[model samples]
Target chain A: MKKKILCVCLISVIYSLVFSACTKDVDFNQINDFEVSPVVESSLIFLNEPANKFYNNGVELTTFQDSVAIKIFKDKFIKDHLVKAELVFETSNSIDRGFNLRVDFLTDTNTLQHTFNFSVPASPTNSVLIYNYTEVFEGNELLSLLATEKLLFTLNLQPGEAINESTLGSIQLKSKGIFYLNIDNTL
Target chain B: MKKYLGFILYLACVIGFSQNKQILYGFSEIPQSLLQNPGGKVDNNWYFGIPLFSHIHANAGASGVSTYDLFADDGVDFNSKLESIVYDLKPNDFFTINQQHEIFSGGFAYGPSYNKNEYISFGLYQELDAIVYFPKDYAVLVYEGNQNNINRPFSLDHLNGVAELISVLHVGYNKKVNERFTFGVRGKIYSSIINLRSLNNNGTFITKPGDNNVYDHIFDLDLSLETSGLVNLTEKTDFEPNDLTKQILLGGNLGLGVDLGFTHQIDKQWYLDGSLLDIGFIRHSKNIESYELKGDYIFEGINPFFPEVGSGQTADEYWTEIEEEFEDLFTIDTVKTKYTTLRPIKLNASINYAFGEKLDKECDCTSEDSEYLNRVGLQLYAIKRPRLPQVALTAYYYRRLFNGLNIKATYTLDSYSFSNIGLGMSAQLGGLNFYIMADNFLEYNNIYDAQSVSLQLGFNYIFN
Candidate 1:
């Protein structure tokens, strides 16, 4: 009888030991502090205009402008996550003419919310002419940029000697946005 | 969202686990062992499992990560830990769960009294199996961004997974051919309620230098996702409560499979036994929905085509054209495509040696019979997976404490850990029989650190 009781007790003890499980200290609330920052790079705009385009029949054209829909900036998710942004412009001129460029961020109703301007120097002696500009938006500027739904770019010819269709050089432009975004999803 | 989370948890509890029942294999004293090796020697003439109380099994395992690694309250920054883990876990890392419960089971010995060496067993069970492999490159791309990794191609092929909830009804035949060998074959009919698979996918997203722009983004995608009977799982879908039950019973997406096993007595003292299980496939033909996106496209950021000078697309025109092209390139086509899936087959083989005084299991006290009270053996187990086969080796010691009680202890080495220890017990109190087994017992003290764990229990009645 004693042996039977001992065996039964041993079996019970073994079963209890095997089934009992303990969890260590774990803080699931830490997810509130989880954050990720990803830097996505993409090409934005490219243009190469010959000097003849600067000629409207016989007179030299002074300014040309165009606009594109900025679909991402107005997104609610993007607006909530975007903390800062930077736009980079790289321009080169083989022609004897320099150009001034103005970028305007507009709302759906064509209301101008933000704007920046930069100038490219002319290569009079046919030397390499390059202009690099970076515009950073933060604090109130970032808010203005996030409210934007459209972007209008205007190019004006700087004061320089310019000819008509016989000119043999071109003005090139390459621009991209380097948006520095800090995203928080913990809430 | 809360309702969806609750439904997912309910499904997991009712369906998932590790399908490998190592300790229960070859433990012939327990009637459930016959399910593992149908050709196993039978100690009783008849048996019946206690309805819903019979055979409950559940297991959750991961190859490279543990709960403590991510959630331990060790005063470390969560983002820092996540970043490190993202870099540490490889594409081969995976998480898997398998679960099964027997609804009913029974077996009976039949034949003329002159030679009663034939037996038949049948049962119905519900099983849930799920596996997901880590997509390491995708994680890195999302976490750290593409600005620094200029040349690396993020592979979408790393994303592979499958989950299924199925009910299986099976009947087995065991025959004792002569005195040296006993072999058995079981045929199964499977009915699946829910299934989702995104396996064997391929694609890559890369960012590189370009002649026209600062960077060119390229997407080479050939991805497809297939699902069956999951349409009503979301809260957005209105479904009757009994619809799920009807689908489980009458959902004609059925399959067939077979299990083969045998035991060979190499002169009593030494023995050999093995089993091959789940060699079958299921044809998903009803209520099937699948999406495929197969295309290769590159983006150089809307080229203005200035080569034609002023005779080129304006900025707005270029943007709109790019948008239209993207819409055409990434159009995901949803189709009612039928497909077939092979079950993850399992192989279990063991070589055992027995010694010590015989435990007269038949109670005949015949001097000619030799059934040892002690046994020591080595078992090899493997299960096919999407990426590779999971394999394990186990060494065990078994002993019969009394005529009605038995104990088995095992040490296993697998991808999880080398120190996995398991224990099982089967006790017969008169006509009522009960058994319980568990693996990774060493981790019971602190389960958060364990990569894998399993438990099984059952109850039955035997008539000898």
Candidate 2:
């Protein structure tokens, strides 16, 4: 009787073990892929003029100067406040360009101002540069002020270049703003 | 929401009954015997029965994590570096980030029979979870040009919670033929309910300039900038506080299930058992929303010059434009869903030995009493405390106190899960025999954390 009981227990044990082992093992390999569906909401801006610069007199705008100036304005209902903006430029042909730029906002008048200056790369080929900026409307400052308002800008673009009216081509201001250079033909 | 309220009222009404118990609906087999013998009316036939009849029969319990308890304390508070730059700006200056609100829940299980072949049972369970955090003060700031500008201030103070109720029904049967062979099976049914809710708060404020602190922005800009009076003229206005509102959500699902078990006694002293459970899924209804926003802000104190409109615009018109321009600012069609419970299926198998005489051979006694357990012998079967992998040995010492009463204590260890110690008695009176058992002698497992505990009362009627 003892032997029979032992045999039955042993057989059952072995059978259960074999069955459990034969069953599928838990797969712990994690296969996860993060697909950030590109938000159609975000925008990408491109400059039509690759160089984004001009020449004045016998000098180039790439030369360092005291300051530079430009006019800015909001295009119709497209309100643009200076939330955050930066100027990005790259040097080519091993030419070095050194400069600085300062920014200011005239909230009451709804205009942003640039009173600083900076030099661009003096590379022979056309170099690309960008001024990136952003602004957030706070309180009713925006709702009431911008219900149907236009944002404008006044920049001081100073360089050792030969300043002229046609030196910078048609003021291709990406934003609803104007650009200008103070230079005389007599000089 | 009305239906949910009605159901809650109904539950309150049911629980109001003094006799209403914390009923476990899963294991109905073991308790059947106890319910029948509560007044102890057994006599005669039970005296000739084996003491082993007093073996334990059932247990019910619950176990799981608290999603609400863990998540409720997650409110957010906003802090800004710009505030630090402005020396006059106090720590309370920045607007807050929205609070984190969510609901989570876990489940339970109950077992009613130890000697699987003799019982059937039922169990019921429920859970409620509520957790959310409210941010104090914080807001997002966008930089235009090189200056800091404040956007609309919004810190969501939302509410989210979930409640669940589940009912399970089960039945098991056991029979021994001749002297050794025994077989059994169990059937089950399940049903459940889930409720959840969400709310939102929105506001606006203006930025002010001025600092009374030593490490203010004016100081930092001057030190790093080397330009005196660079921010001497920099100015901002104080914030004007405004309105707050909320929103609500509703949704749920249901399900069905079945389970079967079997046991066999290979010999007079050896037995084997196994079972499968929860083989089904719960279905749910799609979610639906039912509220909208209702307030606005006035910026007079901050901007004394700017005009303020009291109530010319409707919430709809404002929100529509806000959604069109800055859709990310406000969450539209936010949903809170009840997660589906994933019940894992279980299979059980065990071998047991009875300490009595080997009933394999024929008995010579002809007396009616001798023909019963007397022929098989009256030795007690004591339960074993240790668990030996693959093989578990259990015994009970049965003592017959009266003509129809037999008492015994049982100890069992389900190697796959945990062990159980049980105590109970069986009484037989002619055609009606009843047994009652309370498992876990010393509370190795309780109504909460233990592996499993159950009370089983069973009934058996044999035809001559």
Candidate 3:
């Protein structure tokens, strides 16, 4: 019985020793100091196509503005050509709804001595364009925040006019962008 | 008697070191102050948290080995400190300490949609985790010397199997229970595995002239002491018993969980965001009879290692009684006590600020109502440290062009125990958003490392 007890005691001692070594002492100060660095700066540019809609009144005020679509209606006084032109236009979706006129071709060359007749579309009615006489088309269309009105009536010549294609080579309309909008009146 | 009592006391202390908290997805460890926040419109909430499922994360089953040395590495000082705290024991006893633990931990959360009066939102969320540990070793002692000069050193080694897994999921909803708070939750699933073996060294025996104990046992060739005319001997052998307590068994487990989040906008520029994650349970779906294994083991001359061998002669009659007892101790009829319970939950919170012109208006001077609703500019989000209740800072910058291409850079500091860092990216187009992030870019480090690399992926959606 004594021998048996001694063997058991020996086993117990070994077990106890294992437990003793398991303990560890920790000192918070000695660990290496670590800091999170800032994220590397990278640049990216994304463009969002504007929602499809037209300006308040589709036409622009100035001829210098690009969206002007002018069509010449048939006049009995002129032969082989439609001389009396009634401007039928449509503007982009924008609140400004205006256009400008720069009569360059009219002064540079003359095809016939004909009187020019122009009339504004009815307000809040069937008018496809709105001309804002006050706002002007600034330089660098990409940088300028052109009011939607300028994009509406800025057209210069008829689509099939031979000189219209060459003289007015390009028609461009641009508007400033808007992203996330949270408007709280109380705040 | 006193020593035995003291040993019991030590065991009690070790088991009580930390209250084991099971881990599941979507549970938050964040304090009550942040969790109770009411979500609102125009709020993008963020948070920081830590894993509490140390047991499941360190489980020995998945790794196929015990992590007996994980915390016992050379650099740590827990050894010295632990010695001062435990009861006294001899050197041989130290050999048996199973320095391994089981672990199963994960984290997750999603926010309410960003619109007031209108409760429709496409929130953000994710979850991932793993566990590993070492196996335990058991040894038996033998006697050779008569009443004196008896000595033994630990000589046993073993390997334990281990396993780990992680998953993330979320959905959309509209409806705020209150004007200041919007409550939301997410669902997740996880899985894991474990296998192990115990080895003994003094199994062979040889006849050598000895002064006492005239009888020769199977391991007599194994010298207990050279001076005493005894030779130390060992033979290549393997053991796989069928006893519930001693058997080398493997098991697979799975569970379900949820994540909850709340946000409070303290006036656009400043906001409080808190989230709770991983609340769930694991059930052992399989039975114990499912554990089927097959292996080969070779034994030297006369298998005297097991009692009831040929009576007083050479290897002739095989012993069946001893082997039966072994199986009884190692195998279990049912796996009723095998599956673990609930997993640990974590809490997260963050405060963010935006740079540049703050668009808080309904209409601009140009009669433009939508101009104030752009997602351009830079924002900085600061998070608290991990492990300890401290704070860490992170930054994110966003810019967009006329085209649909959007670019951004974001940095985050992980938990406080070690050095941890992470980065994230996201692109948004016509209601389709995609995101990716790499955490712990420096290199992977467990929670024990003061610095490490961790990664996460994200996605978002918007409805018209």
What fraction of correct interface contacts does each candidate retain? 0.74, 0.00, 0.01
TM-score of chain B of 2: 0.34
For model 3 chain B, the run of ten residues with the poorest summed lDDT:
B224-233
lDDT of 2 by residue, B390-447 (tens): 2222334444334455555555433212344445555556755665545444443122
Score chain A of model 3 by TM-score against the reference chain A: 0.19
Off by over 4 Å in 2: A1-99, A105-157, A162-187, B1-165, B170-187, B195-253, B286-342, B351-464
Second chain alone, TM-score for each candidate: 0.91, 0.34, 0.41
Q: Give the TM-score of chain A, superposed on the true chain A, for all candidates in the order listed.
A: 0.88, 0.25, 0.19
Error of 3 at B6 (Å): 31
Q: Which candidate is the best by lDDT?
A: 1
Candidate 1 deviant stretches above 4 angstroms = A1-6, A49-59, A165-169, A183-187, B1-17, B234-238, B250-252, B303-313, B359-366
Note the Cα lDDT for every prediction shown. 0.82, 0.29, 0.27
After TM-score superposition, what is the CA distance of residue B396 in candidate 3 from its true location, in Å?
A: 6.5
Show the colliding residue pairs in model 1: B16-B98, B16-B99, B17-B59, B17-B97, B17-B98, B17-B99
Query: Candidate 1 at B304: error in angstroms?
Result: 5.6
Tens digits of lDDT, candidate 1, B12-64: 32221257788999898788888888888777788999997789998899877
Ranking by DockQ: 1, 2, 3
The numbered model that scores best in TM-score is: 1
Alpha-carbon TM-score of each model against the true structure: 0.92, 0.31, 0.32
